[model samples]
Target: MKTGSTYLQFLAAAALAGQVVSAETIAQINGNKYLSPYNGKNVTNVNGLVTAKGPSGIWIRSTAPDSDERSSESVYVFDRNFGKNLTVGDVIQLNGTVTEYRSSKAYVYLTEIINPKLVQKISSGSAATPRVIGKDTLSPPNKAFSALDNGDVFGVPNNVSLISVSNPTLVPRNYGMDFWESLSGELVTVKSAHALTKPNNYGDTWVVGDWKVTGLNSRGGLTTVDKDANPEAIIIGSPLDGSKNPAITRVGDTLGDITGIVSYSFGYYTILPLTALNVVKAIEPRLPPPTTLISSGDCSGLTVGSYNVENLWAGSAHLVNISDHIVNYLRSPNLIFVQEIQDNNGETNDAVVTANLTLTTLTSAISSIGGPEYEFVEIDPVDDKDGGAPGGNIRQAYLYNPDILQLRKPNFGASTEANEVLPGPELKYNPGRIDPQNPAWTASRKPLVAEFETLDGKNSFFTINVHFGSKGGSSSIEGDARPPVNGGVEDRQEQMELTANFVADILAEDKNANIIVAGDFNEFAFVEPLENFLAISNLRDMDEAANIPQLERYTYLFDMNSQELDHMYISQALKPKAQYEHVHINTWVTLAEQISDHDPSVAKLNVCKK
Candidate 1:
């Protein structure tokens, strides 16, 4: 055997022979910081109450806890060849060597006891009561991780620095992660918890305890606002009891009192419940009434709606519901920027590159509801070139009421043709692609620029429908990289700059050129991409022009934050007459019950002016 292995075996033998140094409690084993004090030592006669057990080992908690909040009172006893039956609540003493085992080099090391020599069950029937947490007990610090995050601020810079390397000291009461770290491995209870979002694929749901929270929405969720705090929330992970959680859960679904042991894994602080959670109250989501516009009755102004239908296909389950939302909830806007329209064959892997069925079915459904029978125009992308679901052939299309507006097709371009905004308030290829061959747009959706003339025959304005690079491939918020490297950030920045340059080209011809650029940019308003547009093009966000509440300006729900991945921007000429509202028919509802991932937004603008 190796010298190190032999020395460890010798120490084990000496420990079994009663030649032990001294008995230490579980608290002494778990020191305050990342490293344990007795990490590589052979200790014996440590006593604890068996609180939880698994196939490989059992977690034992000291009946008496140390006053130091930094040290945990519970420790895991690892057993390789397990044949013993140690039940919960059994007071036991074990002789083992303290060891820190890291699953991998990237993962954090767990302080535990390896190769337990002698486990003596001393007594049974001693109940270990859980500590109840609520307003009076342990309160969570409002916010997800720590202020020492990638950016000392949350949701700002992407992947500039790393938190693991910073290794900021644990501030339990100040940061949410540190708060949970302080109570690691201890049994606790959260009273009157509600689901913060839908249960994830693994049957885990983020929830908030019964206490005050920042950015509290009407549906009992914390909106992702710039200046809000939600410290009383946590994640209820998969039940350790092996029961499956419900496949779907909506926001505001009341989860009765939860009792679990605190633990950390896969980034977030998770609570491993001993038993499955039962839904005590399920809140039925309510859809808002159709948006009404108190505008010019002559239709000189148009209501434009933008929606990312999340790869919509003709026979998808949510097709009819999506149509209803477009007609009823969005009030049959004059111009609709429809994104993610799948081909005729849906996701079927074939050379079929048309979306006539998808668009026609939607228009026919609107006519059925007494809404306008809209005529659509679009350019199908080259087969498998656009990045999306394989064979989906998803592309952006414009659904306009031909009665109110006319497509300015002085010239039209093919699907692969590049559209450049030139002087004379014209497009080189009307309804054409924007810089398709640019490396920044490779495997990304190209913008569709179309010039529109109001039916009044007195006005013309330009609109660009763009679906920029998505936020996929981005690093996790709790990743090792500081600033949590947001993937595609560079691509998105380039895409926005290109789009802004196109807008600038229009302004170069007519300083008062009325321009409306709208669609799923797949970026938040405050990010660098949108910020770049503000700096270069001097555009105004419709959300700001309409005076929408800062916290409520979101159309998508991702992770624990209700954010905006869909947006609308107006040029200087069209800013004064802009009125916008995000119709919350989809994003605010349960995932299973919603029709689209993005909530469509309707904006009213006067195209006749300027």
Candidate 2:
């Protein structure tokens, strides 16, 4: 070991030779902005206590925390082999270069120390108590995600700017991202953690702590309303100690408490736990009873159901669960609007476009379960033309109980043919595709429209089943984009415009036409596309007409919010008698227990003339 004077002389000589030996405080390196101040600069003699260790690296927190809340006092040291011998509570001194790391352009950068030249354990057994996150200590902001975003994270015109390039100053008290950034790499404890979503495939789970939150729904999950996206929730990533997180987590399940290091990964701020988390209080299984709005078994009214079976085919294993959901949970409605019915080959891409075998399997399954022996109608799309799983050729179809209704003018339209409304206020071809060749519907599912008449032929109604373009390429709510890109919004908007025009033509011929449009729109009810559709068609959302609470109107759960992507709309003449209910067969269950990603909905309406 060299003497202090000798070491000083050596350091001086190294600096003179262009080797940097500058020392930096963790706070100074972190800075007050999104990016680090000392990034790409060599740092020496950085002292901190090893608060946590993981497979890839170790987290060190400064013993002398600064008064400024904008600067973090901790940072990750990226070196898998260097941290293998290190343990928590070991005070260590390291020399490295500060760097800002991100997995992709869509994610915010994480301030870290990389290319470590030296790591020396100065002492052992030093205790570093984690800061508890609660009412008194470091409560996360509940409403907004970023101050950079004006008010809503889901606003339109996304990808306008990136947070990393701007590197705005931190506002920890007002924004959730800033608050989490303030604690990056620091060990913190979350109390009374309730799961916001089920564990994903990698066993990562999102949870909300006991704090003030907005859009709290009846099921204890946060909801995405007009402006709030529940920014207080955080995801619990894989444990730092190389242990698996609980895989059977469900929304609203209590996790008791979790102690972990705050880090950024995969487009969201994550908390990598020091160890595995246990289910402290499991929520009771919410197996909703069958819908109460059953068919009246007459011509006065009809009960209709809408469900997205999630790319189902004749041989799909989920067929049983889906049939159970429709027969038992939805109470066997008079008509069912189903989307994502794959061709008979089930993603084989053999140029076969028919789904006859697929529908027969489902209708047979329903009858086997002691339900209605339904008749199905659909216009198959050109192979691989619709957007879905590449070979699936997914499309929408209608399943109607022949005992209650029949197609009035049963002329099935071809794949590329466009349906029209004639002078009789009737579909030119029953079970026809609407604007199938429109550019707005390029590589997307087309709308399936049909006119139905009661058995007595005294009452007639029309229905349109649509599965619009998906939000596939959308950015994350907490991503760098200000408003976050809602993928396929333009195409979906145009598709809605075309469909609304068709509805307009029908209403032009008959002002009091009884029409119901329902399916997996793959959009929020409050967003521009659906809102524009409702405005143009003069249709009322069934959820609103039925007086469903705003918080209870969700049919899907994603990220931190329970949202509605599936909807049912009725013309003004049918709104007064509409009654709706969302059967939570999928969303309320664990990921393993769910048959599909979306919940099904039922609506009862009077189709007969009043």
Pairs in clash, predicted candidate 2 = none
User: C-alpha displacement of 426 in model 1, angstroms?
Assistant: 1.5
Report, for all candidates in order, the number of backbone clashes: 8, 0
- Candidate 2 overall lDDT versus native: 0.86
- Each candidate's lDDT (Cα)? 0.75, 0.86
Model 1 Cα lDDT, one tens digit per residue, 1-610: 0125665575456445532344467877777754566766777888888777655567788866778765678777766343166778899887777766543333334667766765677898889777776442457777555655633433456555544455555566666666676676777888888887777778788888776677777777777655333545678887767787775677778988998877756655578888777779887745565677533533456788898888888877777787888877888888899999998878898999989998998888888988788988888888878888999988999998888888876576887778876658789887888888888987788988888887776688888898988778765444445445566888988999998998888888888988888899987776677888878877888989989887778787766666778889998788775789988787656667778878899988887764
In TM-score terms, candidate 1 sits at 0.88
Candidate 2 lDDT tens digits, 61-133: 9977788988889999876677878888998888877777776789889998766655678999999788888
Tell me model 1's lDDT, rounded to 2 decimals.
0.75
Provide the lDDT at 206 for model 2. 87
| Model 2 segments more than 4 A misplaced | 1-24
TM-scores, each model vs. reference: 0.88, 0.95
- Reference-based TM-score, model 2: 0.95
